[model samples]
Target: MKLYDVIVAGATGMVGRKMIQVLEERKFPVGKLFPMASSHSVGKRVVFNGKEWTVQELNEENIKNSHAKIALFSAGASVSRHFAPICAKYDITVIDNSSAWRMDPSIPLVVPEVNREKIFSGSKIIANPNCSTIQMVVVLKPLHDKYKIKRVVVSTYQSVTGAGQKGHDQLMKEWNEEEIQEMKFPHQISFNAIPHIDEFLDNGYTKEEMKMINETKKIMGDNSIQVSPTCVRIPTIGGHCESVNIEFEKPFELSDVREILSKAPGVVVQDKPLEKIYPMPIWAHDKDEAFVGRIRRDETVKNGLNLWIVSDNIRKGAATNAVQIAEEFIKGK
Candidate 1:
C-alpha cells in the first residue's frame, strides 16, 4: 500500500489544526505530512502520526514541491483563492473549508453523506459545505429521500468556535472579567446571543444566512427546495445547535421519521425525550456524527416535521467534512 502525501494548508489555525488531528485520528495513510501556513506561522510545531513536525511556509514553490496528493485548506477565502489553485497546479486534490468557490457553477459543493458521488477521481478542487449546512443536510437528506422535502426553516445557535479562535478568545475575555473592545463580532458574546453571524446584506439576511439557503440548494441538487435561515452566535465553545422545521411534499408519521433517521448513514437519532435523552451541544462536542432529536410533527401544517440538530462546528463541520471528502476520494481510487 502506498501512503498518500497530504498537506494541511493554514495548518496553525483552529480548523487546519483540527484537520491534522482528524487525519491522524482516522489513521489515514500518509506518506508525508506537509503542514502549510504563512511565514508568521512557519516553524510552529505540529504533532502528527505520533511525531513532532514543523509547519512550512505556504508559497508557490513550497506547494508545488510538496508533492501532496491531497491538500486540506481551512485558510480564509483570501488565502484559499490564492493558494488552492497553486496546489491544483501540482495535481493535488484540494478540499477547501472556506466559503470560497462554494457557489461556483463548475465546483461541486459536497456533503459526503448526501452527495459523495459528486466527487470524481479527476476533481482537483472540492468545496465542503458550510458547518450549519452540513448537519442540516445530513438530517434533511434522509428525510428528503423518503418524503421529498419542499422547504426548510432553520435558526442556528452556533458556537463561538464558528467564528474561529478569535471569536472564542473574545468570549473567554468577557467571561473571565476582561474588557473586550475589538473582536470578530460586533458585540460581546459572553452570556448573550447575538442575532447575527456574518455581515448583514441589503436583503436583511446575513451572508451566513444566504450561504445556508444557497448552499443547501446546491448540495441537495434541488433548486426547487426553499430555505429560510437565521444564523446566530452564542458563547458556547464547542458545538452548534439548530432548530429546523421541514415541510415535505408527502405526509410522514413521527414514528416512521424516527425509523428513517435511525438507519441513515452518519446520522444518530436521539429522540427519547421522556428519558431525558436528547442531543445537546455539550454532548456533541468532538463527536463526528450529526446528533438529531426533538423530532415531532409540525402541528400547523400537513407533512411538516420539526427537528433539532447538533454537531461540533469545528470537527464534523469543517475538518472532519473536508477529510471525509478526501477519504471518499481515496476509497474510489
Candidate 2:
C-alpha cells in the first residue's frame, strides 16, 4: 500500500482528536502523521495507533518545512485564516473543518456524499460544512435529486459537543453537582437549552444558525434554495438532531422519500414511528452515518415534507467528513 504524509492542525481539539482517530480507523495510507497544536501543547504526547506521537507547536516555519502533502485543519477560523494559506503555498491540500473558507468561491465547500465529485487532486483547499449542515445536506441531497428541494426550514437540536471540549466540560461540570461555569455556553447547559450557539448577528441569527443557512445552499449547489434555521445548543453529549421541513419543486411520496434516504450513501433511515423508532442523539452517538426518521408529508403545504435527522456531530460532522475528503484525494491519485 502506498503511504502519504499528513498533518493534523489543532490535534488537541475535540474534532481534531477525532480526526486522528478516524484516520487510524479508516487506515488511510498515512506514512507520517504530524500532530500540531498551540504553544501550550508543544511536546505533549498523543497516543495514536498505540504509539505515542509528540505534539508539535504550529508555527509558520514548521508548517512550511513539514513534508506533509495533506493537512486537516480544525483550529478556529482565525488560525485557519492565518496558516492555511501558508500550508497551501507549500502545495499542501488542506481539508479545513472551519467556516474560514467555506464561502470562498475559489474553495470547494464539500460534503463527500453530496458534492464529492467536485473534489480534485489539484484542489488545494477543501471546506467542510458545519456539523448541522453536514447531516442535513447528506439527507437532503438524495431527496433534492429526486424531488428538487425548493426551500428548507430547519430547527437544530445541536449537542453541546458541537461547541468543543469546553462545551462538553461545561455539561459534565453541571451534571456533577457543581456550580455553573460560564465557559462553553452563555447560559446554563445542564437541564437547559440555550437558544444561542455562536455570537448573534444583527439579523438575530447566531453565527451557527447562519452557517446552516449559507452552508446548506453551497453544499446542495442550489442558491435558490432558501434556508431558515434556528440553532439551539442542547445538553446532549454526542449527536445533533434537526427537524427539517422542506418544500420541493416537485411532489414527493413519503414512501419514496424513505426509500431514497435509505439508499443514500452515509445515511440510515430509521423511520418506524409506529414502534417508536426514530433517530435520537443517544442512539446516533459515535456513529458515522446520518440517521433519518419521521418521514411524513406536511399537511399544511403542497409539495411539502417533514423529516427528523440525526448524526454524531463529531464524527460525520467533523472528523469523518474530513477523512472522507482525504480519501477522495487519495482515490484521485
Candidate 3:
C-alpha cells in the first residue's frame, strides 16, 4: 500500500490525541502528518511516528497548500462544517468524528466491520457514529442481518471523557473537593448522573439521545427499525456502557445470538454470568473491540432480548472508527 499524507484536526482534544496514538499503534503508513488545531494550540507538539510534530492552525489555504490527501477531523461539528468541504474539494477524503455530516445524505456514515463494503475512495466525507451508537451497532449488525431487529430501546451509561478533556478536568476537580466548575457539562458530573446531554429538543429528548436513535437507523440502513434512547453522563472515565433491549423480527435462541456475536468482527463476547465475567467500563477501557455480555432473554415480550455493551469511547467509539474509515479510503474500498 502506498503511504499517504494525513492531517489530524483538533490535535489537542482527547479523541484527537488518541487518533494520533492509534495511528502510531496501528502503524498506519503515512508519508507525513499535519497536526492541525486552533490558534491557541498552534506551535504545540504532538508525538506521532516516534517523533514530535508541531500543531498548525487550521485554515483552507493551509489545507489546500499542504496537499493533504486525508484528514481525520475531531474538532467539532462547526469546525467540520467549515473545513471538510474545502478539504474535500481538494480531493482529500475526510473521516470526521463529529456529528456534523453524519446525517448528510451525500456522505456515508460507516463502521468499518459492519459496513465496510458501503465505503469507497470516491466518498469524500465519512461520518463516524456517536460513541454510544458505534458500540451498540457493532453488536446489533450481525443480529440485525440474521434475525432482523424490529425495535430497540437503549439506555446509555456514558463516560465523562465523552465530553472532552474539560469534562475530565471537571470530574477530577469535583472529586478532590475543589470548587465546582460547570463548563464541560451543564450540571455537576461528579457523583451525579445528568439526565440531559447536549441540547434538549422540542420532543423532550436530548440531542445525544436522538443521535443514538437516528444514527442507528442510518448506519443499519433499516428505516423500519425503531430505536428509543436515554443517554446519561456517568462518573466513569473510559468506556461507555449500554443496557439494550431488542426485539427481533424472528425468534432467536440465546446460544445462536452468542455464536453470531462471537464470530462478528470487532466484537468480543464476554458473557459468563455464572462466573460474573460480564463486560464493564473498567475492563473495556483502552480496548478497541466492543465488549458484550449480560445476555439474557427479555421474557416480558416475545422475541425480546437484553444485552450489555461496553467499549472505550475514545478508541472504537471515536479515534479508531475515524482511522478505520481513512484506512478503507486508502485501500480504495
Tens digit of lDDT per residue, candidate 1, span 1-333?
768999999899999999999999998888899998989998999999889888999898888888889999998999989988888888998999999989998888988899988987355999988999999999999889889999999999999999998898898888788877677888878879899988899999999999999999999999999999999998897699999999999988888999999999999999889999998999999989999999998999888889999999899999999999989999883
lDDT of 3 by residue, 1-333 (tens): 688899999999999999999999988899899999999999999998779999999998789877888899999999999999999999888899999999988888999988887677356888888999999999999999999999999999999999899889899998998876467888888889988889999999999999998888888888899999999999999799999999998998999999999999999999998998999989999989999999999999999999999999999999998888778767773
Q: What TM-score should be assigned to candidate 2?
A: 0.97
Worst 10 residues of 3 by lDDT: 114-123
Native-to-model Cα distance after best TM-score fit, residue 158 in candidate 1, in Å: 0.4
Sort order, TM-score high to low: 1, 3, 2
In model 1, residue pairs whose N, Cα or C atoms come closer than 3 Å (at least 3 residues apart or on different chains), thus clashing, are none
Q: What is the TM-score of each candidate against the true structure?
A: 0.98, 0.97, 0.98
Name the regions of candidate 1 deviating beyond 4 angstroms.
Answer: none
lDDT of each: 0.91, 0.90, 0.91
| Displacement of the residue 267 alpha carbon in candidate 2, Å | 0.4
User: Against the hidden true structure, what lDDT does model 3 obtain?
Assistant: 0.91
Q: Which pairs clash in the backbone of model 3?
A: none
